[model samples]
Target: MSDMPATPLLDTVDTPADLRTLKPAELRQLADELRQETISAVGSTGGHLGSGLGVVELTVAIHYVFNTPDDKLVWDVGHQCYPHKILTGRRSRIRTLRQGGGLSGFTKRSESEYDPFGAAHSSTSISAALGFAIANKLSDKPGKGIAVIGDGSMSAGMAYEAMNNAEAAGNRLVVILNDNDMSIAPPVGGLSAYLARMVSSSEYLGLREFAKKTIRKLSKRAHNAAAKAEEYARGMATGGTLFEELGFYYVGPIDGHNLEHLIPVLENVRDSEHGPILVHVVTKKGKGYAPAEAAADKYHGVQKFDVITGAQDKAPPGPPSYQNVFGETLAKLAETDARIVAITAAMPSGTGVDKFAQKHPERAFDVGIAEQHAVTFAAGLAAQGMRPFCAIYSTFLQRAYDQVVHDVAIQNLPVRFAIDRAGLVGADGATHAGSFDVTYLATLPNFVVMAAADEAELAHMTYTAAEHDSGPIAVRYPRGNGTGVPLPAVPQKLEIGKGRVVREGKTVAILSLGTRLGEALKAADALEAKGLSTTVADLRFAKPLDEALIRRLLTTHEVAVSVEEGAIGGLGAHVLTLASDEGLIDAGLKLRTMRLPDTFQDQDSPQKQYDEAGLNAEHIVDTVLKALRWNEASATGGGARA
Candidate 1:
């Protein structure tokens, strides 16, 4: 590490309590230095960058003004908490962020006293802050409770729900609306346009104060008339008439980067013992860094890069990522079929649907952070004779489980779900892992679940889902690059419930699902060296198990093993259910299932994570040998020889 001169104000403050000793001018210097540290740290670690950079001044102002560690401060998405984390005494370990036994990428309540509520998904801060406010009021420990949320997160319906409830309850809560006019991408929807209108209104502030002063002077008989006038004036001046109607003391459209304006406004809200207040602070995403300011979305999360040149490290060339393949394949399919449409929940570029959105602008929809709405909306589109492809990450898809069951499956709509990031995701850790989709969706009545073995298979599955006129169909693919397979000029559909046998052997059989087929193949080769002939089968569809193929394998092979890149309640559990029903266990056949253990895997590289979970080839071979009790015979070479 380079020995750059640290700012004196920053060096003296280790906690929020220490921040009180610094003067307001000194805090400005501290904010600048903090921004520099955040830029450097994230540049080295390659994690959330733009959000943190945008919120640096606001973070400093909040910690400086609020009595933190007692007065609760909640950050909505927690992607912007790097500045908060650094100032709260985690700076020394900042280099290890999002790594295996180091600091978490988001705000963790267990990690420090400063983080009151933790969040990874968007639009949760207001509810959490309200909970704290109510608790504080009930407990009689009267302190300020604040929720700092971004304009991007504000698009979700849940934020409005929380605002409505908070206003109705009339509690002393402060909601700092950090309006940068962007989420991951430039925000969409009527709410965003409304906020923009309010931000642009010239007479909004002057009219609000005039109405409040005029309302106070009116007699009891004319109070109703005063209220009516105030409402009418507010509706005309500020476009947040919807929020005021919900009963909040609305304040802002202020300059968030200017500490002079932000501090006094925050202090006024903090001191006022009023009803719920919403302070709208307009900021710029990637405020200070020039490269980041030019492209906020690209810098939102970035790879390690050079500071001076602002050039990101080039990734090694390999097979295209599964997300890219899905996007390209879907675009090609949509060219021929005008009925096909794509939908994403606030992620156009991340899910690789940006290309499709560009080509088919009229058919593409970008619903902001509202997964439930996305699913139900797709169902509606399907009902109208349009083929809707709902592209979302697996973990995020969990948010819309009820919609999948009620809207899509129950109605028997042909909504094709392209589930990206369907396995262990590296860097982002457990909260973002795509581990539970196979189990969760497989149990739904009218749903068909399938996993891709490689890029080619993913294309085939996409083609299959688009053509299938049956109920909802899902095709899940992992996060990273494919297996370097050659592309097909035209896509073809696969048999719905059929599986292919890769290698045939009589001693043991491995029924692999999804991306684990490659590992099973490698294990089969390794076992052959020890005189253990192994069979490998790729079960394409998880919901409808290929009973004939499974029965054939059970009759021919002495022992069988099931493998998947998911948890206990997934493919392995389903196979066991079949075995129990068919009385296969009573016939003296040995069985073993290899799935992720019943514990949350920690943060690590994808390769290391697979090895640790015993899902790799060497461990699979060992597990199969141990299960068959043929270890000694295999060592002596008395069984089938290689």
Candidate 2:
């Protein structure tokens, strides 16, 4: 609390309505205070710091210019929304971000009315904002849909698709392209700022409209030539020919950090009569903060750090991260196998593909934010006799599911899918949680689904997937570091459908999948202490369903419980379906399945999330005990079966 920054101007404004009351000259101080408040808040909470720092002036300019709650403003990928959140009545709980039962790192529709649409995914803001614009246009309402998208997000085809259809929205759609990474034009200066303000001004637009009518009164070819010459002149000056071609009246390459330049341009765009408008505002990733400006990526997503010094809190050194383990293993394996290659959809370092790229830059490819293309590209490589591993986060992979099915599974291509973040992700909440990959991928035909219980198992599964040319094989792992198990020096190629029993017992059988194997073993220990002999089996493959191993465990044990860190339709559903098909459940078999609850979990610590979902050791013990009691009651005929 003592380290919190002084924000006198920010304290006077709670919402955009309050922000709109300030004079144009006072807004610069308000933006400065807002930036300080954002840095201080994120310093304690440790979330996206650099992106929010970059957008402080822009956030102030937008809220000061527009009626925000009424005029829907959608942020692409929502990482830079902390400053916006502070400006829009969430500063009190700003320090509670990414914690249990607190504010989310990304925007949520349920959180506030100011956030018109919730977004954590990339390239969806334009589409969502267009929907709002068209709906308002249809209802004859006085609201505009403003989409703030990044240049990196523009790499996806969806943004262009939305732009192509944006002509119908008329003047109600305003797209602010936040160009922080790629400098789309020459640096913003006095001339460029003046051009942006002049072009967006109503006087210039009115004169242009009159000229268009006058030219149309002559010949159609003359009108067309006049428009082309005018558009090309502006295109050469401001560098927005591409956006002009997409049916938007392109404006700017203005300074995003300069409130003097940004406010007037935004105010002009709001008052203009254009159907769809695109404003290109260039900014640095970390504009005001010196530490973040120096190293943008390191501070982009940060940990709790000192306010005076930007030194993030580091976790105690232990085993390597699961991603790094996979990357190193793949790189090592690729040395012997020339066909091995790697692909990632913009997240090279996040997915560990950067490690592979470092070893073999020619083979490793970062295809930007195009997951659909990544999957299909890997499929093509596989068809051409190259072992292409499409490494992507499980949440992002949902975008390319059609490609996974049509391009890979239907063709039976051997494209190896290295699914990262394959379980409940902490802090990022349900939006980034990889909760459905097992359920989704395991159900598909010609797909081999494997969940690694530890980093050692991940290495084996990685090698296994590399060697398997039979069909499309996938290996999924969690977000954090491995469970400290010693990685194999020489990785083994595991059998496709065989599961290994980690702990042996007779009375209770706990079938485990993914990283929840540790909890399953702990549950076995607790069950054994309670006079129950428990068996824990790490069922690696979720698809093929280790029928023989599962059948033996189900028949031999008094109670069989399936434990997996996935949704209802994953390992438990498969095992249940197999039991029903083989008539294993008809013989009074007491079967129980432990999985994540049927709800989207909020941001929390991983341990608390698992406990809240009732998938922890104590929950597993309770489930086994409850089932055993029901079995005993059914056998005695004293109580009815539960």
Candidate 3:
């Protein structure tokens, strides 16, 4: 608390209404204080930092000019909403961001009225804003729908799609393109600022409307030529011809950090009667923060850090992360096989495709924020005899399900899917958790889905997937570090649709999938202590059922339980169906399934999330005891206890 910067000006503002109460001269000081408060809060709690810092002045300007809750402001991706949150009555809980039972890392409509729409994925803000705008327009309401989206989000086609359909909302829709990457427009300066203010002003708009009316009275060809001339002339100077073509009145390339330049232009845009407007504002990522400015991506997401030195707390050394292991192994495999290639959707480092790119830059492709294209592209490559691995985060890959089904699965393409973050991810919460991949992919007819039990198994699976060319195969691994098993020197090519017995027994059987094998082994230890001879088997493949092994274990064991880190309709569901179809259930089979609950989990530690979901070792042991109907008197009776 003592290390926090003094926010004398920001302390007075609790909401946008309070921010509007301040004079125009006081805004510069308020923006400075807001930036400090954001840095301090993120430094204490350790969530997104650079994006929030980049938009500090823009956040202040938007809230100051617009009537917020009534105006309906939506932030694209919501990672930069920290500053927006702090100003909108969540500053008290700022330090609890991404923590258990604290503030979410992204915007939530339920959290506050200020957050009109919630988003975690990119490129959805424009569509959501359009929806709000149209809803208000139809109801004959006075509020506008304002969307603050970054340039990176504009890479997705959804933004343009929304823009194309925005004319229906008339003057109710306003899109602020926050260009932090400086990729779209040229450098912003005094001339551009003056031009932006002039173009958005009432006088300029009124004159333009009058000119349009006069031009409409002329011949159709002449009117069209005059309009194209005017639009292209402005486009050459402002770089907004594309947006103008999408039926929006384009303005700016203004300095986002300059309160003087930002507030006036925004005020003009607010008052103008334009049908649809796209304001381009240029701002530096990690602006005003020396350390973050030097390396924006490093500070984009962070752990708790020192505010003065900008030094983050390092996690203790542990086993290599599953992502890096997959990346390195793929890179190594690509060395011998000329056709081996890696593909990722926007996230190169997050999916470990960056390592592969380093070795085979020509073969590895980093497709920006376009999952559908990435899957189909991989499918195309696979169809032509090249072995392509489409490495993507499980939750993100959901965006390309149609492509996966139509382009790859239906055609039975040999696309190697390296699904990263395949289980519950800590801190990022339900939006980012990989809860449904196993359920979704296992249901596909021509899919081979495998889950790794440890780091070593992951290496083997990666190699195995590289070699397998029969059909579409996917290997999923969890987020964070793997179990510290030594990686195989020469990777093993495991037989398809098979499972291995890790621990042998005669009474109770624990069938594990994915990283939950560790918990299954712990449950075996607890069951052994309770006089139950427990057998723990890592059933690696979720699809194709590992039929022979599952049948052998189900018929022999007194009570068999399937444990997995996926939702309903995964391994447990398949196992239950197997038992039912084989008449094992009619023969008095005492079978139980353990899995994630039918509820979305909030942001918390991975262990706490799993504990809450009741998929831990203790829960497994309890499930086994309950299935056996064990009592204190008959606890040591083993299989006869039932």
Per-residue lDDT, model 3, residue 200, is 91
Candidate 1 weakest ten by summed lDDT = 183-192
lDDT of 1 at 409: 89
The parts of candidate 1 lying over 4 Å away from their true place are 3-5, 168-171, 182-221, 231-239, 630-634, 638-642
Per-residue CA lDDT of model 3 for 1-642, tens digit only, reads: 688899888889999999999999999999889899988999998999999999999999999999989999999999999999999999999999998999999999888999888789999999999999999999999899999999988888889899999999988999999999945885458999998998899999999999989999999999999999989988988889999999999998988899999999999999989869999998888998999999998999999999899999998999999999999999999999999999998899998999999999999998888898999999999999999999999999999999999999999999999999998999999999999999999999999999999999999999989998999999999999989999888888998889899999999999999899999999999999888999999999999888999999999999999999999999999999999999999999999999989998999998899999999999999999899887757454453455
RMSD of 3: 1.1
**TM-score, one value per model:** 0.93, 0.98, 0.99
Residues 247-313 of candidate 1: C-alpha lDDT, one tens digit per residue: 7766656666777666766776666655687776777888889989999888999899887777898
* lDDT (Cα) of model 1: 0.83
The lDDT per prediction is 0.83, 0.92, 0.93
Candidate 3's TM-score: 0.99
**Residue 82's lDDT in candidate 3:** 96
Across 112-167, the per-residue lDDT of candidate 2 in tens digits comes to: 99888999999999999999999999999999999999999999989999999999
Model 1, position 68, has a per-residue lDDT of 88
Candidate 2 — worst ten consecutive residues by lDDT sum? Answer: 632-641
